[model samples]
Target: MIASGCDCEIFEAGPGRVVRRARDGRSLEREAAVMRHARRHGFPAPEVLDADGPDILMERLEGPSLMEEVASTPGQAAEHGRLLASLLRRLSGVPAPGWLQAAPGGPGNRLLHLDLHPANVLMTPDGPRVIDWANAGRGAPGADVACTWLVLATAPAGPSLEGWRDGVLAAFLEGVDAAAARRHLPAVADRRRADEHISAVEKAEISAFVARETALT
Candidate 1:
């Protein structure tokens, strides 16, 4: 077994296969379906080999995560940002599958990766491949982008890593409309607040940010 998270445990099944067993069987099934859909649409995602009950067997992608690279290779911050932005653009352009539904108060038509962050992206030989589809669904592109921005902005980092984060955010927003993303911040923050994974301190920070941004708008 390689990694274990709150929801799932990942194991290397063999040279080409990886097994993901989720505590919640339904969520694992949903994740497998989402990956299959993404792959069908030419998105960079794992190929699902089998999905039985709570276990999902998928193609093993080898490489460091984008988060690892960003923390270790500060000089490549801009490049990573560009790559992430491109991936977001591509994901946003893909039409959501019929079974997907938007989160409450979010746009219902656009495909959204609600939890897309550096840690969820793997730097593969082919390129960066997005993983962890647990929070993906149909929603506003701005909401998705805003969620990413929030994650980047609020992530705990040391003094040394702060500059890298800033560079990445700067590059990410180079061609993006800051206003549009900012507009969704409050909504995204609200959604994030309800997540069990968020700590009380983090929730308080997000809530305060939302209140401040709401007043300005």
Candidate 2:
């Protein structure tokens, strides 16, 4: 993929994943802090081998990504629904140090991986490895779920795509405050404004998903 943005080339590697700096020193430091905290709390994630400015060398994961696995299943939607919820819950339980984002940004007291999506999850032989902590921070847990729903809703679907998006989304909303989680467009919109740029269509889809989930919940 082409680079240059909020964090450019941020991923240079010598053998495995050697660096992740394109984002800058401050970004690298924050990510490193989060990674270290995750590792300490036993979160299945990459090890920060080194962190110097925007450069962050990381341990390479040795396994298939969740994106790859999802391609092979007829019931892929269901599988992803189950996997995403369980993993996020586990991540929430992992306590970061006091210096980290200790307080929730809003209602929920759980830590959130703002960029949670299937692409960031690697399905290793041992278990799932959550990657890409660039957008991670302390926030309501529902924000994370809202992000996931946005992913499913906005992901490209060809005429050949066979699964039901609604079912997959429902799978994601099976537990907790599924309704309130869906109606989090304002939060999602705010997040997009502060960080990455989600497409207008994608944002609209997210808004719709948020509404639908809110209604169904």
Candidate 3:
């Protein structure tokens, strides 16, 4: 078994399946349900093999995370960005389940992966499969995209990573409506600020970005 994060541990149950158990049983069950919903809607995600209380058994996907691949192969930034954009677009078309709450918006009922980022994507032999559905919910597509933008912008970085970040951002924006994403920056920032996991530095940065974006609105 391997520790995945503060709340969960993962174990390779067999050649074809892995099990994830979270500290919060309810959250784990919700995550499993969201993953199943995503897979049913044709999203490239792990199939749920079984679910019992806080433990979820899922198809074991073998591959390095997209974040690792992008860091090692900077030249493939554009391709990876395009793939990510396509996945987001597909996700936008999926209807959120009734249980999920909308992200302070009206008119759209899209399922949102509130924490979509390269680290959550794995490049399997079949394709790029998204994981970590614990934060999945309902929201406007623009808001969801804005959350992704903030994640990319605030990721720990050094001078050398700037070029790779810009390359990926440029490619991703080419496939998305930049104006729409900008419109939701404030709301996204507000939501992120409320997350207990965010550090003071990140909250300040997000606040500044939100202020700038709000001024333009």
Candidate 4:
């Protein structure tokens, strides 16, 4: 296996291809559809070759995830943050198809990657390519930005990683709509709080972070 996540494992399938298989045996049709839609709109998403049941065959991305890059070179956190912000901005411009479900909080025509974060971005020779469309849907762009902020701010991290999160977040907010993020933060926090994969400690931190951020805004 090339890598593994909470719900999936990536395995090299052949030259330029990899298979992402869900651990819990869920269909990947929706994820594939979202990726194809994003790609059709010129968004940077991995090319989906096939999706069947729990497995999605996609073009193999070369190089490290944005998170891994930041972890190794802390000095580049700000640069990566800007890149992330730009990616979010680009994604927000894509019009959502009717088949895509609406996310919590508000109705919008924009596409949203509810799980977007550094770990989901791959820094390739061509550019940054976004991966993992499982949580993608339709929502206000700000809500998506708020989701990214919440993840960066409250995800459980080690000492070194924790130290750099603030810097990355600050840089990212500078490039995006900070006010929008603040506006939608409460709803995002509530959604994250109910996530089954989130730890209790992280959930508590998310609540505190949301409260402080919203109050300041």
Candidate 5:
């Protein structure tokens, strides 16, 4: 077990994991490219120091996890959501290298960060540094947003659920025109319809249910 100074609990076993093996050169290369792209495009992510092999040395961040940091605060949650929305827009605006491909586990035709939870973000002195880029790629920003909302809805709920919703929508759409948001809401919402159609989220009550779970815990 290679325990670095930071929160790195890596293993050097040859089990196909990055920190477990001496290789996965292709995966390392892809990770480097993604990190570089995020950096160049101004997305808050870790800096890559070495990307030659399985053990891609990189800068580790310090500070609170976005989840714990804002777990008790709705205002903070809203602001964070807004920032994420802006970040997604910026990342999508840029052209990713050819190597970045859509690899959704479920049936989908768009790129997405299928698992974007707050735990994956590492807050640093600069700001929130996006920790995990393994699930990022060219996909529907709407679905990404939905997945984001899903996690947000599931995480530690704030004092006021409706207020948090207001803040998230307000911040997430800070620069977006009201008309545009209204117009695109349906399309953005349609992406989540797959889950309902497939019975993953069979009813509107699911959102409230998740909120209750987070709050009660």
Candidate 6:
């Protein structure tokens, strides 16, 4: 296995492919469909090859994740942040299909990657490609940005990354509608709080972030 996340494992399938299988026996068909749809709309999502039951075969993305890049070279945090902002902008341009589920904040006609963070982005030879579409859905573009903001603002990090997080987040929000992102922050906060995978420490960080941000309003 190449890597494993909270509920899925990634395995090398061949020379240039990988298989992502869920651990809980849930079907990955919807996730596969979402990736294909995003790709069809010209987004930089990984190309899906085949999907059945709990496994999805996809083109292997080669490179370190954006998080790795920033962590290794802290000076590049702002630049990578802008890159993430650009990716989010590109995704916002893609029209959401009606069959997709609505995102947490509310319903809208834009593709929302509810977990778009540095770790989910692969800095590939071609460019940055977004991965892990399990939480994707349709919603207002601001909702997607809000989710990223909440994560960047609160997710647990090592001492090395803790200080740089704000730099990356600031650069990312500079290009997007900060007001709109703040508008959706509360909804995103609630969603994160209820996620079963969130650790207690992370939940406390999230709550603290929410209180700080909300007080400024």
lDDT of 3 by residue, 1-217 (tens): 8547766789889888899998665547778888898889998878998888889999888899988888888999998788778889999989999997666533468999988889899989998999988777787898778878887776666654556788787788888776788888877787788988888988998887777766886
lDDT of 1: 0.82
Q: State each model's CA lDDT, in order.
A: 0.82, 0.67, 0.82, 0.90, 0.54, 0.90
Name the runs in model 4 displaced over 4 angstroms: none
Q: For residues 7-122, what per-residue lDDT tens digits would candidate 4 score against the true structure?
A: 89999999999999999999998999999999999999999999899999999999898998888999888998898899999999999989999998688899999989998999
Off by over 4 Å in 1: 25-27, 158-160, 212-216
The per-prediction tally of clashing pairs is 0, 8, 0, 0, 2, 0
Q: Name the best candidate (by TM-score).
A: 6
Error of 2 at 7 (Å): 4.2
Q: Which candidate would rank higher by lDDT, 3 or 4?
A: 4
Better of 5 and 6 by lDDT: 6
Candidate 2 residue runs with Cα over 4 Å from true position:
1-17, 23-26, 101-108, 158-164, 175-177, 183-185, 193-196, 214-217
lDDT of 5 by residue, 1-217 (tens): 6543222344543433334123323345566667777788666767776665545656656677666655557658667766667665665565555566854323333334444556666677887787666556665455465556554443345463545654665566563333322322333334444442334443344445444434543
Candidate 6 backbone overlaps, count: 0
Per-residue lDDT of candidate 6, residues 170-191 (tens digit): 8998988878788788899998
Candidate 1 residue-wise lDDT, 12-87, digit = tens: 9988889999866654778788889888888998999999888999999899999989989999998878877788
Better of 1 and 6 by TM-score: 6
What lDDT is reached at residue 183 by model 4?
Answer: 86
> What's the lDDT for residue 175 in model 2?
48
Candidate 2 yields a Cα-based lDDT of 0.67
